[model samples]
Every structure is written in C-alpha cells, then in structure tokens.
Target: VDKDRDPVLGEFFTTESIETCADSIVRESIQNSVDARSGSRPVDVRFSVGCVTKSETGDLFLGLWEHVSVSDEEAGRLCAENGFRYVTVEDFGTTGLRGDPEDVMGDDGDEENEFYFFVRAEGKSPKTGQRGSWGIGKYTYLDVSMINTIFVLTARGGNGPVGGSGPLAIGMAVLKNHKLEGRAYMPDGYLCEVRPLTDGDDDEDAVLPFGPDSDMPEKISAAFNLQRADEPGLSVVVPYVPDELTYEELVRSVARNYGILIGWGDLEVTVVDETGDVATMDSDSILAVLGSLEDNSEREELIDELNLALWGVGLTPGDRTELGRHPLGKHPSWHTDGLMTEEQAKIIRDELAGGRSLAVRVPVPVTEKPDDVTRWSYLDVFFGSSEKKANKPHFYRQGLRISEIPSDTVSGLHALVIIDDEELAGFFGAAEGVSHVNVSSETKSFKGKYAYGANWLKFIKDAPAQILRLARSSEEDEDAGLAEEYFHIPEVEPEPEKEDEPETDPDDTGDIEDPVIPPIKRRVRPYTIAPLVGGGFSVTVNSEVPEGTVLTIDVAYDMPNGNPLKNWAPQDFRLDYMTVEVEGCNLTERSGNRITVASTGESLFKVSVRGFGSNRDLFVDVSLSEDS
Candidate 1:
C-alpha cells in the first residue's frame, strides 16, 4: 500500500474534548499576538467563522469550523520593517486543528507531509525578534480537522525565484484525500485552490486536477473559482466543510477562536450563503459584546443585593455616583433618595483617606440584630476618598478597629459602641469612672462614682457632707439616732457566790499589787516690774508647770520694791489688757486668768486660786511687787 494511501490514525476525541482543547489554544494565540504588537505598531485582530455540514451518519464533524487568514507577506514585511517580528494565533487545539482527531494524525512519516491553514499576522516579541516560530502554529488547523485538503496562494511585487523571490509572494494547495485512479476529494476539497484574478494563457494550469479522474463528489468542486488579487500578499482557501456546520456558525466560531483576524486590516473574511449572497461579520462586534454588560433592572437588583450582603459584613454602602465608578457598579433609579448626604459623604471620604487601619463603630439597638439593622450601622454608610490613590481616610482607615459591645457582661444587651481613633491610647483611663446598669434588678444596678485626676478632691469633700445628711435623714425618719442607739452600753450583772467560801488572812500568801501614785501639781507665779520714780520695767511670769494647760493669773505692783510706796500707780497692765486663745480648740478668754494655748512660754501669766477644800477664804495671788 502506498504510504500516502494509508488511513490517518488517532483516538478521535468527543466534541466536548474538542471545545475544552480549543479554548486554551485560542487564548494562547491571542496572547502571542498581543505580545508581538505590544510596542510601535498597533495590531488589529479579527476572528471569523464559516459553516460546516455533515453528509453521513459516521461523519462526526458538526457545526461551523473556524478559519483564520492573514496578509502573509504584508504582515511579514510589517514585522521586518518595524521592530515587531512575531505573529501568533491562539485558539488552535493542542492537536493543532479545530476538527476531529483523524485529521491531525495522517500517515506518521514524512511520506506525504500534512498541511494546515492559519492566519499569518505580524507582531513584536517582548523577549526576542522573530516572526512565525517554525510554522508550528501554521499546521494547527490540519492536525484537528478531518478535512485533508489545504490551499495557499501569494502575490509578489517582483517575481524572481520559485517561492516569489522579490517582494516575496507564495501560494500552494494540498489534496490529501485524493484517489489515484478515480475521482478524488482533495484534503482541503476543491475550494482549497487559489484562482487567478486576471484571465491568462495558463488558465488550464491554474485549474489543477485533484485526481486522475473527475468522477468525485461535485460538492468539492462547488468551492472553485475563489479569486485572488495580484496584491503583494498571500491568500489561502479551504473549500471542504462538513455538512453539519452552517456558514453563520462558522463565522462566529472563527471570530471566537482567532480574534486577531477581525482587526487585521488586510485580512477579510466573506462567507457565501446558500443563496450565493455573501455576509460579512466584523470581529469588533463580538469583542464589544463580550466586554459589555446587560443593562436591566435584574442587574441593578443583583448589585443592590450584593451591597446589602456586604454591608452586613461591615462594608459601607456608597452613593449611586460612587457606586458607578466600579466595573460592576450599579444604581437603581427608584432608590436614589437613599443616597448619602454631602456631610456624610465627606466624612466617609475622610475616613477612607485616613488608611485601612482605622475603623468606626456606630451603635445599633440590641433588639435589632447586626444583620438586620441598616440605618444605625456604619456598614450602611459609604466611606473612602473620592480619589483612587488617597482613597481611605486616616481616622476611619487606621488605628484600633471599632466594635459594638453589649452593655452588661451577663444580661443586658445594651450596646457600647467604641470608636478607637488611636491604637496605643486607650479609650478610657483608670481614673475615669465607667459604669453599667443591669436593668433586671432596678435598685441593685451597677453604679460607679469616681473622679479623674484632681477632681477626686471634690468627690472626697462632698462625700462626708452627703453621708452626714443621709445619716441624719435616716435617724429622723426612724425617730431615733441610729448610731447612738446601736452603740448604747448595758449595765453588768453581779455573779452569784458559793456558800462554802473560806476566809483568808490579809497578808498570809496573797499577791501584792503596785501602789498607785497621784499626779503632782506645780505652781507658777506671775510678777509685774515697775520703774522707780520716773522709769518703767516689763513683767515676766515664771512657771514650773508643764506645757499645754490653763492658768489663772493676778498681779499687783508698786513703784518701789517690797512695798506699795504710793497710793496708786498707773494701771497700764490691767486684768483686761490681753486676749488669750488656744490652738486646735475654741476656748479663749480676755478677763479671767484661765487660758489655753498650744505652746508654753514666758508670755503666759500666773493665775490665782480661790476655791479650796475647807476654808472659803483660802486665796493665793501670783502677783509681783514692783521692787522685787
């Protein structure tokens, strides 16, 4: 058997496998194209597909097959002239074709080289300067498609060699499924050939035969007469398509697969329908569709629901204008009234600008679960700066995170919302009295009364006054002095004695007790000094008594010593001359000799004692004569 005649061999994959494999291929091809076109020239890529139809039950090919064509020489020249030297095609399957497995594994050896069709576009490689890597991607179409025929054609500016040497243009066709003796269906079918634009003497040569005979299915011939322009580039045609595929489906599939073809300015795709009317589809339309979002109330509702859900998790809801900034941002016309006020918006912007470290806690009612509460929660408020970079505010963005806490540690569910503006500085100091109330027991509620810093002095000063008033009020209400009544002493009862008591002598063998000594009293005298004739002297008191006591003093002085020399002397030091006072007590006197003072000194005067035990006339005057 001829090597070319051998049947293609491979495990044909199902349609699902083909789609999975195709997705990755398409992505990689587009990435390569994008990378090549990164700098210098912009690359416009377009993808288009044509229809396919199946003829028999065993024929597995279905729907439309993708076709990618590029301006080969033009793209190559663009790459060489510009810095871009790479052209890539994505969406080709791992097997290199968009069709069944049998199409890819035709005759393992090089006996009959299998060929595939692909678009050739130019781009710059980010890493290296290169265009078309060894034609590896070029054969991707043949590897997957069961179609055995391939067609390629090129036009040259200056013809010099076999491969179009000058301004190089080249075109070729392959018919792998052709029969040698009878009519044969070309591997790419009859549509694989490239027809000349201008009629020439070699028209017969241009119309190449697929096999030795012409009795093959006319469906392959139906693809003939595809004209090629004499422009400076290549044109390729693949004619045979499975009956299961439609032209529209094929165009869509190709557009989805090789997205670059649509943007290729020189490359254009036209699919003729059954009526012979050609329809053109732009790849940009598909791209626009993919990038666009559906505008509807359902979408708006979905966005609102998401916002509500995230709000429960502590994210604040933003206004419609702010929400419009996100890619998925949505706003409902009906809910516009619920937007934030200008002040609230400013606060949110400031908080977000602060940084992610800050957070604020807004108090919510205990009856309203955090998940259910909306208005009172911070989650309902929008935060963050209007600018993207300096977005979050410092206070709300940084410091200690805020949280809402229950009022009582055990029972009451009151919320203590604490917004920690700073992490290091605690919200409450030690001296700051903090209290909570358990409403369960009305009177036994928790109450703390303390002062911070110097304020404690005021609390201390008022405490005694308040306590005294409370004590007095309680006593008045009860008709009794509580403290005095509670502290009253009772009389002691005498013990009963035994009848058989022995008599004891006073000094026989008894314990002796120490004798008690009485306290001794010391006497102090006061003296007045006077001058003789015309001069005067000062008086001093000499006291032998100890400090801190009251004494009664008297003094009488004459001009000469030891005698009352004159009838009378000027009474300068009278009984009522000096005033007396005691420290730490309210006792004071002006006339009497009795006085109290904390210190003892010579300034104190002597006192006179009048009252005695038996005699009413017993008197002692602590007076000093002027002469002595």
Candidate 2:
C-alpha cells in the first residue's frame, strides 16, 4: 500500500499569551465572525453547552466510538455512558464558509475559499484585513473537544458553494493515527457523505456532501445538530466537550475581551451554561458586567483598568481633533495641528490637566513597500489621569485586547488605543507573535511584510505620551521638535576600548587599556524603562521572574554635545528626591544616575520612579546587577 496523505497536526496546544483555552476559543470566534460580517451591523454570537441522551445521538457515533476509544479513553467512556456533553457556537450577521468545498489544488485565482480552507487546509490562511490570519485559530476548535471532533454547519451568506446555495453539515475529526481491521487509517475524517465508505470498489476520497438544500439528507443534519433554516451565518458544534471548559469561564472571557465592542453596539453574545441558565450581553448590559468583573488571575486589577477605559471612551467629549498625516520622523512623537480653534486645544489640555478624560482622533500613513503609495488609517486615543500610577497602556485592535507588549506609558494615567481600520489592523496583526497577544515588529510576518513596521509601532507606542506632553505647552512650543534630538533612547553600544597601541608615545598622557572583559549571562533579564508623563520612567518586567534578583537602573539626560553619562551633574537633575514605587520588589539603593532593587515576587515585577526634575528624552539603562 502506497500510504500518502497530507501532514496533520499530531498534538494540540495553546500559546502562552492567551491565558486559558477558554479565552483563546472565545476571542478567535468573535474575531472570525467580525471578519465575515455581511454589513455594518453588530455581529451576534451565542455560546451554548448542554447534554444529550446517548440514544438520541448515538447513531451518529458508530465508527467514531472506536476511533475515540483508541485515542481518548475518557471521551469514549462518556460516549459509552448515557450523558453526551456538547458545546455549540452560532454566529449571525456573518458570511459563513463560502467557496468550493474540494479545492485541494491551490489554483483558484483570487477566489475566496473559506470553505476549502476550513475543510482541509492546516496552518495556512488566505485572509487579509481580518483577524485569525495565521490559520492557527482552526486548531483551537479542535483543542476543546475531548474526542478531537467538531461538526461545522455554516449557512454561507454571500455566495454558497459553486455547486449551489444550501445548508452544509460535516463532522470533522482529527484523532491520533490508528489502525482499523489491520489497515491504517488517516487521522482526519469528514462525516459529510450519505453513507460510510465500506470495503468495496469505491474510492474513499470520493465521499462528499449533497449538492443543495433539497438534496441534503437527514443524517448529515442529525449528526452535527445543525439547526439552521436558511440563515446566513456559521455554527460549530462540538460533541463530548471537555470538562474543564465551563460556562462561567467562557462568559467571563467574552466580557473581558469584547466588552468594549458590546458597549459600542458592535457585538452581542448569548451564553447558555450546563445548568440551563441563560445570559445575554449587549450594549445596555455590558457596562454592568464590566463593573462587576474580577481580576481573573494573580495580583492584577483588570476591573479598575477596564472601567477607566470605558470612561475614556464613553465619558469623554464628542469633539475630536484630527491628527493629520505626518511623516515618520527620526524619533517617536505626535504632531497636533488643524484644530478648528484655540479653544479646542484648551479644552483638551484642561481636561487632561484636571485628571479628566479626553479622547482624540489620530491618523497614520503607511506603505507596504516595494510599493511606495501611502494610505491613511486612523485610530482613537483616549486618556484619563489615574488616581494611582498604572504605568501601562491598554491597547485594542479591531476589538481584540493586545496585552503584554512593551509600552512606554505616562505615569498616573489610564490610556486606551483602539485601532478599527482593517488595513491598518492587518499591519499591526502581522507584528503580533504566534500568540497574537502583543504588538511587536520582530516577528517574521511583520518584518517580511511592512516597510516601516517597527517605526510605526514605536510611533503608536509613544503617541499617547507625546500628546500629553505637548498639551501643557503653547502653540509655538507645542511640537518641541528640536527637543526630540536629546530624547533619543540609544541602544547599548559600548565605545570601543582604546586598548592596542600602534606605537607608544612618551608624550601621550592617556594609557592604553587592557582587553575588554566579556559580560556574563544575567540571572535577571532587564527591560527598558517606560517614560512617565511629567519627568521620570516606569521599569517594565515580564511575569517569569524570581524572588531575590537585583536590577540596576541607570538614568541620564541625553546631551547633544557630549556623552550623557560623562556630562551628568547636579544642575541637570538630582536622583535624591526621586519618588519610587516597587511592586513584587523592594528598593535597596539609589545614587546619582543609578538605583538598585531586590525582587520579592508575587505579581509581575515592576518599578516606577519619578522626580527627574527635567525631561529631555532620557538615556536610561536597566541591567542585571548581581547574581541574586
């Protein structure tokens, strides 16, 4: 036997950025539905979980029972018992999986083939201007299934399959490679055809679905529990849903991840838990849900952060200033111009100064070169002064919360940046890593695709801080453009040691130096400090940190003429009066231009220190000081 088949995933896993399987699945579902939206309306998605009697759905599990037992004994046992747990997600206001069903040969010219991709493709995508582009989201569905099976029942909106327009139902399963009747069977199987392929002259691959709604058989509908009556949307029904995934987890994730969308009337979700309790989330009820949300995990206060963001978006004034297209300059900064009147600027500044909320419209121009033409994409920036120092910014791209990225935040301020434009969203989406939880330009997708990807990212990162800084200045001094030269954060490049002397001169006053000692591997990983609104900066750290490591933070004002460190003096600024904040760490020592800390871990290690007395684009260095 020639045994040839497409490479299939042998194991299922989730990325670290997404906290849990529940969060991953819910976010992916909403993202995909929004991408397939038929029109400019709120996309409706419902999550339902229930149990069914084995006798009602047992016939659908004939051959699957054996395959399930081979790989997942627990799922097989559940099937053997009377209780059969299931989860179904239905999305209205969507264009379901549309295209040719059997497009295995990738020769379709500019044709949208969500159907073929959903049916067969693995770890690939034909998506642009839409979320879930990396093609990793499809596997997330399979991960929550105990028996590695899910049923796809999509009523495509725009155009049905090339064959005809009708409802489609298919049972998709990806089990561990196994053998049946002394012959090896492939892991992927579809329950679309009328009858199971038996030992005969017929080819197994030819097993497929009926053409139209009239021709569709009862078995296909019965197997997947596809309860669509010519509605335009998609449905994913999973049988034997895992025990760990509960209604409470799913609903909470939905609220945290998409609460903003719900408040904006962009999305609505309904959930029916195993206990038969039903809850619906929409624009009216989302705020109530958010007001009562929990922190979800350790040491973080997400509710306060979320409520403040809602204030920035919902409570801020309707008047907006257009931040027009400005070239990507040498450094990260914002240019605010074209305000209708001076009063507009005054209002914006006064609100921020009073610790109130202010929202502004910001537009950015970008190009994917080899092509030079630029297009405009705008995003919303909301700012509210916080009672306590957050030292972080909340970012959302097309209604998805992008967290854990390195951001230079203004101390004592709550900031929210929302990107809605599809074209620009794609640019930032590529910059995200495999987890899709951060915005960074180091990834292959961003570096390979965008011309100024990294520059644009830094521009957005510094946009909020730059605006807040400029609001305190007059029109003529608004930009402070020249000041940016001194504010540049220089990458560490030690001046080359003048060690080897070509010829020794008696008159030479300077002595030749010894060879440079190699720097040791650090026990404490150091991240750059985020600049605050007024003068100082907040040190950023990842969650994976130990309890007793020392970190050295060195700071100096960048001088255009001489070395920042060598030229530092008491007149420039004093570190003596600095106000320092330490979380999961304790301050041990502070001197001129340097501060040391000993970490005591619980929450993510973070340190915010103010009172620089001067702001000139600081030259800061944070390094692992000791061996712990």
Candidate 3:
C-alpha cells in the first residue's frame, strides 16, 4: 500500500458525511420544540416564504436568501411524490419529539439555537392529543434554507398573563452564515431585531407596517396576520422563508407527521392565501386514522374485565379490618354454636370450609383474527383445605368441563387469573387459610353454565390427604405409593415315586394259559383304608411307576344288595397318592358289587365304582393271574 497507493482510494476512505438528511434533521428539531410546549398549553405555528434576487453588489441578499435554494431538484421531487410535502406543521411541532433531544443535537448547535423561533403561538394545548411542553420544535425550519437569518414574531391571546391588557408580542431574529469567518456557532442565539411599530424607535430597528407603500416585501408582510376572534388562539409569523419551500407542501408535511388529532374536539386548521381565500381542515379525519392504528384495544378492555371478575372473592385478614370487623371475626370455628342455618352465610362458610374450586371459561369471538385451537385456553383448579393452607393448590385439573358458545349467543370473551394465593401473597401479606382470586371474561356462558353448576365436580376430585402431606413435606420424598406393592406365586413340581421289590425269581418256569401275558409276582402288603361316610373310600396307591408315565385304574364296588356288577361310575373321585383315571366305567353292578373292572396287560387298570342313593365304595384285589 505504501508503494502504490491510489489517490482515489485515499479520498474514498477518508470522506465524512452527515448521518441524516437535512430535511429530517430540520423536521425532528421543530418537532422537539413543539412537543416541549404542547402539554397543558396550545401552540400556534405559522410559516412564510420569499424569493431572493441578486443585487449588483457582491453582498449576499441575507434576508430572503437565508431560505432560498439552488441545489438539485431531485430531493424536492422525491419528498413531494412520497407525500412528505403534505405534512401538518402544527402536529409535527407537537408530537414528533418521542426521543431524547440530546442525541439529536448536532455540532452545529441548531436545536438549541432554533428554540428562539419557537414562540408559544397559542396559550393552550394544540388540537393533537400530544404531550410536549418544551419549545424545541422550531429547528425544523432550518432544513429549507441555508440563510443565517430568521425572523420570528409571536402574539399572546387574552388567556395569557397580559389577558385583556392588549396582546403581548415578542419578535426575534437569528443568523448563520458559512462564509462569515471568525463567528463561533451560538447554541442559544436569539437577537431582537423588530420592535413594535408604535415603539417610535429609529427606522433601522423598527419594522415597517405591512402595506403597499412599505419597503418590506409583499410576500413577507402578507404572511403576518392575527388569528380571527372566533379562533381563540395564538399566531406566529416567520419572515425570510426559503423561496424553494412551498407553503402548501410544508403545511401538508406537518399534517402527515403530527396529525393524529386525538382527544381534540372541534379543532380546526386554516391556511390563508394572499388573496384572503382560506382553505380549512377538521380534526375528525386525523382521529379516524388514530382509531385504525389501534384496532384490538377493545379486546384488551374485555380481558381486564375478566381478570377482575375471577379474583373478586373473599376478604383478606388485613382487609377484614377495612371492612369494619376484627380479623378473626369470620375465622372458621370448630364449635357447632358458631355455625348457623342462615343460607347465605352457610354457603359462604361451606365454600371456605370445603375449600374453593374456581372455574374459568373463555369464549372465542368470531372476528377477523383466527381463533386459537389448542386446549390450553381453559383453566381449572381444585383447592383442598390442607393444600390451601400450605399456599399451594392443584392447577389445570385435566378433566375440567368446558362448553363453548358461539359469539352470536354471547358477547366477546377471554379469561385470565388476575389474582391467586401466590399472587396475593406477593402483593399483600399471606392470609393463612384464605385464597382471594379474580377472573374475568366477556362470555357469560363460562360463568353462568360452568362456574355456577356441578360440572366442576366431575372434573376435579377433592385433593386426597396424601397429597396434602406431600405438599407440606420439607424432604424430597414424593413417593406416595411406597406402602403398596404386589407379588406373584411360583408353581409347584410333583415329587418322584419310589421303586418296588420283585417277589419271585425271573427264571422260574410256570404253565401259562395266555402266552401273550408276562409272569407276575404275587405279594401281600398291609394297607390302611379310611372310609368316607357316604360311600367313597380314600386309598393310597403304592407302586413302582416310572416318572412321566400315565396311569389308569380299575375298581369294583360291592354294594349291600349283593348283586354282581361289572362297571360303576364314581360320583366323586380324586387321587391322593398319584394321578389315575378310569375308562368305560358306568353304573352296571346291582347287588353284591356296584362296579367291576378287568385288567388286560399291566398290573395298573382303569377302575369304576357305583353305589345306591349317592353312597359308594370300591376295593381291588391284586394276585398273580391263574393263567400265568
């Protein structure tokens, strides 16, 4: 860079420029002054323009030249096309000072110096409902001119200090010239140049009367006039206005910026031409614009009402004193004598004793804005005595019932909890067991249908005692189900059987009538049988049966009738020693035995027994088969 720096690059990087446009700076300054003086007192604003012509001498025509311009017309055309030229000067002087003035003050001291031009034109507030009590708005006029000189004249009305003592007029002149060397910029510079025509001062210091014979220009003099008697306000006269600034465009620009004429009843604005023809505007148009700016303002009001209704119940302990009663007068008494049958009083007492259950309903009004479709719009709470005392209550009971009504059937609606135990404690001191709350809505159905009905009971159950203890515990133990647990029973397995001893040698030969049958060992073993009273006998079967093998048994019951029987069905049967079954058993025996059965292969056989009149018995004899 040091070896081959370009002059163009150096100039581009080093250039400095003003941050804001000249017109914006001027408008902002004037707005600041108007805002300062707009509170509690109205201010009148006036504007004037004059064209300056060069004389033979090199001396600049400082009077009219102060407001004239020779710059390019591009900025002016842009400002006019965008409706900037239609601004209302008076409103800008009143409402445009929303920010701090110190940040707007430039090194030129334009804001402070321009204050002298901001004479309180009226002794009352402007038509616009704006609060600006400082006279800082006059600086905007500087945007239209480069001239160092400005002339200001202000006349006070009967409402001012000199009321009915004749109008008090104050005149001031200000000057700024870039070519004038050695002149330091003055922050609060205002010089009195024009005196009352009747002052009889020297002609150089006195302003000539505004007439055809006067040396004063027609344009400058024509702008000065007293507001009509019916007008009942002040007037300002600005001399040496820039020729380039059109009075119509300047008035319109002022209207656009500050014309939200709120709270101003029957206010009027008029501009008089040199021919004395007047053009007028009313404040109603501006009011309409302001109304459009804030469309949802009514909904907010409804919300406020809902909040008030929900929380407006029960007096606090401190509030009891304010109600002309002792704090403990209405306290709950365990003694039965303190309770009475008075219906209204009983309802109150029961509500307090049983704990309060607050329900809120919100309605969706049909409007341009889309309605919220989520379930969160509804709120329900169930307060228990213990939980209430602990300053905590159940919130958002899941099953709260809500019924929505169409907007045609009701007024607009929204709901909110404005106050509750926590909020009351935060705002006022705690009321040990009392919770005061408020909720409001535009809909009556939420209040009439839900709040006054039994629907709330179905949604929120009374808080259990366990929940109260949990709320009061200082420890972090929230396991409420610690005392309850469940267990499952395991299944049992059957025991294995013991093997039996063989009674005869396997090598003994014997005659066998049935060759397919195996040889059997006969043995006698003592057994105990317990006879059941009806007819069934409990028997223990001892055998060397292998595990996992199915077993079958056959038995014959001998009845008192003494008739031989072949089959009998056991009325009731169960195996105590081992599992067994009978096949093809039926009631066939009549006299001696009620049932009988024969074995085919194994010593185990299916058994059956029967008895008369529900009485039955069975016996089986085990012996080696005669055929073997």
lDDT values, one for every candidate: 0.26, 0.67, 0.27
lDDT (Cα, 0-100) at 273 in candidate 1: 51
TM-score of each: 0.23, 0.69, 0.26
Give residue 240's error in model 2 in angstroms: 2.1
The sequence of per-residue lDDT tens digits that candidate 1 reaches over residues 475-559 is 2222113222221111123444435545668778767656544444333223222211111112224443344434333323323
For model 3, state the Cα shift of residue 255 in Å.
5.5
Best by TM-score: 2
Residue by residue across 1-628, what tens digits does model 3's lDDT show? 0011112222212323222232332234333334344345433343323222232112212332322221223322332221112112322123221211112122222332222223322111121212222122233343333332333322222332212211222333333322323444321223322443343435534322122232232233233333322222223343334333454444443333333221132123444444444444344453333333334643233223223232433334332111111113222211113212243233423453454532222111111112322221222222222211112122211111011111110001122122222222121111110111111232121223222122222112212211121122222222213201110111123444444644766897886445343444433332222332212222222343222223223345544454313444433232221111232222122223222233334333323121212333344432212221
Candidate 1 matches the true fold with a TM-score of: 0.23
> With candidate 3 superimposed using the best TM-score fit, by how many Å does residue 579's alpha carbon deviate from the native?
80
Model 2 lDDT tens row, 1-628: 1112233343225344577767878988888888788889899998987777777664566678887776666766766577777878889988887876544544323336777667756655678656667655777788778787887776766543564555776777887777777878777776766443333335435444544553333554564454566777888877777676778778888887887777778899988887879778897887666555554432233455556556655543355565545655333234334422466567766777677767877777767877766777877787766654435677888888887765555555667887878778888888775556876676556785665668778777666655654454333331223434435554554544344545667898887788556554334334534555555666766554677778877778776687878877866655544456555676778667777888776555766666554535787767754443
Between candidates 1 and 2, the TM-score winner: 2
Query: What's the residue-level lDDT of 432 in candidate 3?
Result: 10
Best by lDDT: 2
**Candidates sorted by TM-score, best first:** 2, 3, 1
